[model samples]
Target: MSTGPVTIAVVAGEASSDLIGADLIRDLQRLNPGCQFVAVGGRHIKATGAELIQDNEVFSVMGLAEVLKDLPRLLKTKKQVVRTILSSKPDLFIGVDSPDLNFSIAKAMKKHGVPVIHYVSPSVWAWRPGRVHKMARFIDGLLTLFPFEVECYSGTGIDARFVGHPLAKQIPLQVDKQRSRAQLGLSDKKILALLPGSRNREIKELTPVFAETVRKLNTSDEWQVVSSNVSEAKQKQVAKLAAEQQLELNFVDDTSALLQAADFALLGSGTVALEALLSKTPMVVAYRISPITWWLVKTFRMMQLPYYSLPNVLAGDFLVPEVMQNDLTTDNLLTACREVINDPQAEQRMMQFHHIHQSLLTAQPDQAARAVLNLAESLC
Candidate 1:
């Protein structure tokens, strides 16, 4: 056994992935004193004592068109990151989400004989199923958040483990709506939580439509609309869009609290939808990518799954209404909200949320960390 500290190279390119990385790093440090991390991530991972090579913002863009626009610079950064990680001579490499960037870097590390683990399986099961074979070529192990994802790696020769979702454990099975509302200074009126998205491009694409939805909803005092506070610049952009629709929205910093207080969540199709589900909040998920990207996806028949939202994907059914692309008009969004609000089966839906939430709870908190270190030791 080695007496010296073991170094782990990591890359977590989004806020959600950063949270996962932070938890994993904390466990690794607790189990192995002097466990060091070199990473690419945001505040959460950096706060865990990882030396960040670059801010996560560089790889934040999504969709084919958006990624292409920043490809040159992203490629430059990736090359630099690859060189830095290789030179670090890490005992192990962990790529947390952001498969677009991490897979390439993981491939490089694998070529150099570094044991590679990919945290958070990409949506290969949902689309581009062929990615499973590609991943088998690089990663020594795969850590998946959802249970169903492990089945996707069967026969791929990758040691895939279902570490359970961190959020499922972090969020209580039952939420106190009134208490969360009191904390956020929210009224008892039907609360509508709007989370356009975290990234600038996502906010820009969705804010206008969201603002219009608010404008239509403003016709009556039945709804009190709120949004989660994002970056100051993005907040200002949202305000500008709302102003164009002659509407103003209240912004709160605690998204989890807001979701708990909300009677209904109107948000983009991403992690926030999962948050809303775990909060036991009814929601209508909406999303719109760039036109070219949408066209390319459609023309090429890239999407293997009918649903896009995390909750829906997890359930393997359309558990919630998904308003998307050209269909994501203000009228449609409003109608979906109304449907969720008036649905007779709302309580049944909450029961389903409970079922899914319970399904994601792992008995051990350190499974991910233990799995990573076990892989590293095996390589030696």
Candidate 2:
């Protein structure tokens, strides 16, 4: 092991990964008091006292078309970040999600003999299994959030470990809906929580449709609509959109609290689906990427998974409604929302949600921190 304090360099591309990076940083601080951190991250990661070489906004774009549109800026940012991290020469480099950019950075840093640990395994098991072979060549250790992910790296000679997911620990096994509703000052009127998404592009694509669906669902005054906001900018955009449609929407700053208080969630496909599940809230997942990107994914036969949403993926069964791509219409969303809201087997689905939550509870606050430090010190 090194005689001096270890310096860790980390990069988290978007909001969810930023949360994971922040938690990992807190744990790292607890374990190695003198260690320092540098990163390319968002507000949450920056809050942990890590020196930010770059903001994560440039790397936040999703889909092939979306990335291509921002390619020039992303490439430039990546080059600058890689140069800076190499010059700093940290003891270990941890890439939290954003496999597209982080993988490139890891490859460059590994050439200079830096130990590279990737925090979230890319969706190799879901699609593009070829990536696992390429990952084995550069990543010294792979830290996965899900239990099944470790099996994907079999015989790759990469040190793969399941650290569980931080959200499993952060969100309790049982959430109190009445208490959450009370905290949000909400009345018990069968709330339907709307989560268009965190990104501006998603807000643009999903809000109008979500609002239209809510209008159709609430025609009989059977449901109260609550829109969950991630930031003030996004909240303002959603509020403006709601005004244009002349729709009434209640806004909440806290997503978990809204999810807990909600009777049903109509959300875009992402980490929020998992949040809804952990909160024991029933949901219908929906998404719409650029048309060209969806066409490319189909034309090339790139997608391998039978289901796209995390809840169904984990359960190995179709546990929720997924209205996506061409199927993501206002009518389709309304239909799915009604199906879940009035289903007789809702109790069975809730039990399955609890089972999945228990399975992901393997994480300790310091589990990932201890694993990362052990690998770094081993190479020292």
Candidate 3:
């Protein structure tokens, strides 16, 4: 007996999710050989040969204020997505990250008798534990990055699997610092990478602080700051900022290379933190958002982790200092950056980061792709 192609609908709402979704699609296709995919994604996902219904930009709001501004567009897109999925009736609906958008869409699609798999658990373990109940109602399975997240869905009887982070598997545990530096054309002198963020708004809010911090740090050491490019617009914005600040900066399309090249990194909190951790690069995490959005996040108590950086969070300690909101000032950021740069024990701490990196890698084949393939097989 021969099985028909398994149709999977995937929605990935951010750059990191786009990369992960693309890799997942490749693995799923490898397993079934004839699987079909359609949904909203980015260039990376498009490269995987998936039919794109919409681009991820439709649902890429970063903060509460931003979400509010884009609410009407988001709602319209959600309706369109629901209508499309209902018309097509895919066997599996894979929601890759973006809990706010994907979870709502999954909830609506569940009524059509499609299995909903939520990849990347929203931090219910950290805050708003009540979300688990809603997730259980809509999601058939939850694929988590961290092992600790599996317990969050236990009470709801939700099928949760700890598929170690894709980055942990993608990046090497011990990067050759000299080789990376040589690849990026940098001297053996102290190198500091500035990852303001991948989003335009993130660069606007954090780049100034990061630039100023670089200026402060430059007083002590000749540091080379590198910015990651997500778009031409962001690259131009960062270039302008770097020029205005009179800072020596390099622009790279791949942030992973920048992480590997740097001795330490000053980054905005998000996916890059995990990437840096996997590269075993010591970093200082910093972030800033609109005042109203900050107030809302604080009032709602959504952020529960003591540290924002993924390495520190995974290590269950303050492995890296997090300077957020008011603390994200140039002076404070410089202090944190300097501490990581000057500390003699910094390399030792990065070695510990390497150990954590190894622990998160798949023991067998690529766990991320295998996990998605397993889900696809079950649907078939």
Candidate 4:
């Protein structure tokens, strides 16, 4: 074993990535106490003792239009990160989740002899399969959150490994809903947890539709309608909308706890859907992006998939309903949610989720860290 300090350069752009990056760093430290992490990360990564080179927000935006608006700042941040990383010449570079932003950065760093390990394979199996060759040029190791992604990289000459997802192991197979509800002081009549997503763009697009759907629920007052926003600003926005619509809703701060409390959830199609599934909460996923982004995705055939939500995709069949764009209406959403809420099939769905949960409990961080370190060692 090498006695010298192992320096790692990491960039994690969002909350989910931050959590994974943090866990990876903690496990890497366990493997080698002399490991030093230099990163651009959010709270979770910082909690694991990384010296943050920049805040994760510097690269946190989604959709074509949103990214276009922040392109200049993003470009500048990439240059700054490249310069800083080159000066130190770390043993490993780990780009977590933000492949749309971090892929180019990793490619640039590879020119300077830094071995890059990208955590969370970009949805190549679903779309953009051509990028595997491009990824192979820079990424020495590709760590995946899903088991299926490993086969997607086969014959592409990329060293891919499935590290599983931390959420699977973190959440218990059975969530104590009654205790969670009591903790939130929620009353018993059909609790609905609304997760509109964590981004400002998501809030702006989905909140009105969700607010309208909340209004249309039968015996609305009997059912406790609650939403958890990612920011205080979004919570305030939901509050204003609730007042305008004359609806009663509890806006909570802790999303995980809210997922535990939910009998079912109306969520935006993203990581939250997976979280809700991990909590064994049946959900109706909905999303509406800017028309430009929607048009570009359709026009270019960017990421055509049979199912968009993680649960449905993982199951290889429809376990829940996911409505997108114009179909994500108040009436459609309300109807879909009601059907899911009162379904006899929900028990089977929950059982399937439990099996998926167990399958995904493959100890993510240790596996991911070991993969990256093995690549680093081979490079040495």
- The all-Cα superposition gives candidate 2 an RMSD in Å to the true structure of 1.5
TM-scores for candidates 1 onward, in order: 0.95, 0.96, 0.94, 0.93
Off by more than 4 A, model 1: 1-4, 185-189
Q: Show model 3 residue runs off by greater than 4 Å.
A: 1-3, 185-189, 376-380
- The residue-by-residue lDDT of candidate 3 on 1-380, one tens digit each, is 02467678999989899988888888777766767889789888999999999988666678888888889988998899888877777888999999998988998878778888889998786667788987888888788888888888887967788888777767777688789888877777877888888777888888877887788788766676677776777788887876777776777777888888877888888889988887878888988888999898788888787766677778889888899887778788878887887889977887888888876766754676566666655643
Off by over 4 Å in 4: 1-3, 183-189, 363-365
Model 3, C-alpha of 306: deviation from truth (Å):
2.4
TM-score: the better of candidates 1 and 2: 2
RMSD of each: 1.7, 1.5, 2.0, 2.1
In Å, residue 259's CA in model 4 sits off its true spot by 0.9
Per-residue lDDT tens digits for candidate 4, residues 256-333, read 888988988988887889999999998899988888988998898987587888998889888889899989888899
For this target, which candidate reaches the highest TM-score against the unseen true structure?
2
Please give, for residues 71-132, the per-residue lDDT of candidate 1 as tens digits: 99999999999999888999889999889989999999999998889999999887889999
| lDDT comparing candidate 4 with the true structure | 0.82
Error (Å) of candidate 3 at residue 258 is: 1.5
lDDT scores for all predictions?
0.87, 0.88, 0.81, 0.82
lDDT of 2 at 132: 93
Q: Cα lDDT for residue 68, model 4?
A: 93
Q: Clashing pairs in model 2? A: none
